[model samples]
Target: MHLANAPSARRFTGKSNRQARTLAATLVMLLGLSQLAPSVHAQEGLAGSVKRGGVIRYGHFQEPACLFGGWVQQWYLQRQYSDNLVARNEDGKILPWLAESWTISDDKKVYTFEIKPNVKFTDGSALDAQAIADNINGWLSNDPDLRNPTAAPYLGESFESARAIAPLRLEVKLKVPFQPLLNVFAQSSQGILSPSALKRGLAVNCENPVGSGPFIVDKWHHGREVTFRRNPEYNSAPATARHQGPAYVDGISWKFLPDQTVRYGSLIAGETDAIYDIPAVAWKDANFRFPVLRHLTGDPPLRLALYTARPPFDDVLVRRAFAYSTDRKAAVDTSFLGSLPSRATVR
Candidate 1:
């Protein structure tokens, strides 16, 4: 984890980042020092640790149409209530999660996963291989509503089938080799949900997709907020997880605050434990008061799409001219108060 330097602050200090890639990068707390889980506190030394079992009032910028969605913001909420087959550590190493360990065939098309035994959904149903298969094969189901938008893209192309040779063993075959499949599996969108919840249909399932994660979605208050409660029965912690048991916080009160200024104000006013991203204009001031951790999402930077199938963009000259015409650096510097990564690709 490439962490931003922490500066001393009095109360409710905050930080901001670019398009945050992981929960760690985005979930910087107002409590100061990472308190996402118990293991992290252990590493930081718990002399000044905040008491466990308080609800985290997280201020967010966007709301997903459903609790489960294809958008990054939705995945952010999903991460609180779902577990993945595998997890990626700060060192960028793959670690076991639902899938204890896995093996790839010589051709690299088939992956055999050794599922962790004794794992059960919050609903008390067993998380067997067939359940895992149901999620992967949702894209091919005749029922359009049953499709998992998050899992379909990767599974649809080159995907042969996912089946259970045994109750706790999953076999997934692909027609073509995709070495990056493991990395994809660790994505937030790939977080596994309970099959029992899917049977409820999209309407109910959207608000109540069950999973064997640390948190359970209690309710989605439309455009207001979403409330989550700690899963007392949760046991499937990712290898990269900060703790081994249920989340340290009792629950999370995720508030949907779109305005950056309002969100930051909530933090300063002691209204929220953490806000998603700090305003760029407030970045310098934020540093002096709070320990700010910024995530520079530039490795795969945001792109400027130009539709070349028609119109002025179809012409190469117009495309090049438009591309180089904008003073993106100046705009970003002024807007973000010179707080983002400078490296960019004009083309």
Candidate 2:
């Protein structure tokens, strides 16, 4: 992938284009030298020769996204292959990613983001402010009259205009001063993509997607599996745990196995490293010893959607009574094996 030099109006304050190129060249030379050495530590591994390589196979309990599923699938694919301008951590805090920093106008109707420099798409396309603006335009094009909408209603009018301030800075004008506009920007649906990827078409390239994330799509077997390899050009890394330099694993393979029984069985047999939607009965297996991570499925406190504008939900008293009488904890215990706790309202 190639990245053009940042325009004068861009806000990135790091090394200039020439300086970055020099550093990259120097690093390449050092890497080549290290490869010739017998004991040199590669960045791929934490210890030893550091020439780590392995494929992480995961089991899925439902049909792959191409066959069925909607935004959730799109969200997962984006997370796997792309980085967002902002990221919402497990604690619900939004942090910067593709955007080095940002600001809001006094009226909060305008938000301007300073994009990072030297970012590139897997397809060898430059990822610039104009590309981001174009992606936003794409979302805006389909936001209205969407048959199946995401959780956020503000997205319907998320932007008035997305303008390129420079090659690496974009200014977005919102129709109204929405308080949670930044959160909407951080949503996976709003993840940035190269102009070429959008032009090539989303559905045609859904399985073999491309982005500027830590990993790149290596191969995709439709309805069977998808594989990803570490991105050698990933510059902006998250301040998270374990991962440093390059990705810890060499590659990852996502296997599509719709049968929950087969998925769990494969996990138990050590054929797969992870499996989604564990069965309730399998939780009690004392011998099973793998980390299980769970999170609030829906946006903040609400898991179930309530159509307050509709008939039964239109009555305030009835809604409140339903919220009160419903034993959320009991339902969670019986349904999700006590993995999730119920919250009172949608946050």
TM-score for candidate 1, please give it: 0.83
Best by TM-score: 1
Candidate 2: list runs displaced more than 4 Å: 1-51, 64-70, 142-153, 239-244, 286-288, 296-347
Supply the TM-score for candidate 2. 0.70
Off by over 4 Å in 1: 1-39, 42-47, 140-142, 303-329
TM-score, every prediction? 0.83, 0.70
lDDT of each: 0.69, 0.55
Q: Which ten residues in a row have the lowest lDDT in candidate 2?
A: 5-14
| Candidate 2 residue-wise lDDT, 252-307, digit = tens | 67677788677777766766655565666665451235433332333323245577
What is candidate 1's local distance difference test score? 0.69
lDDT for position 312 in model 1: 78
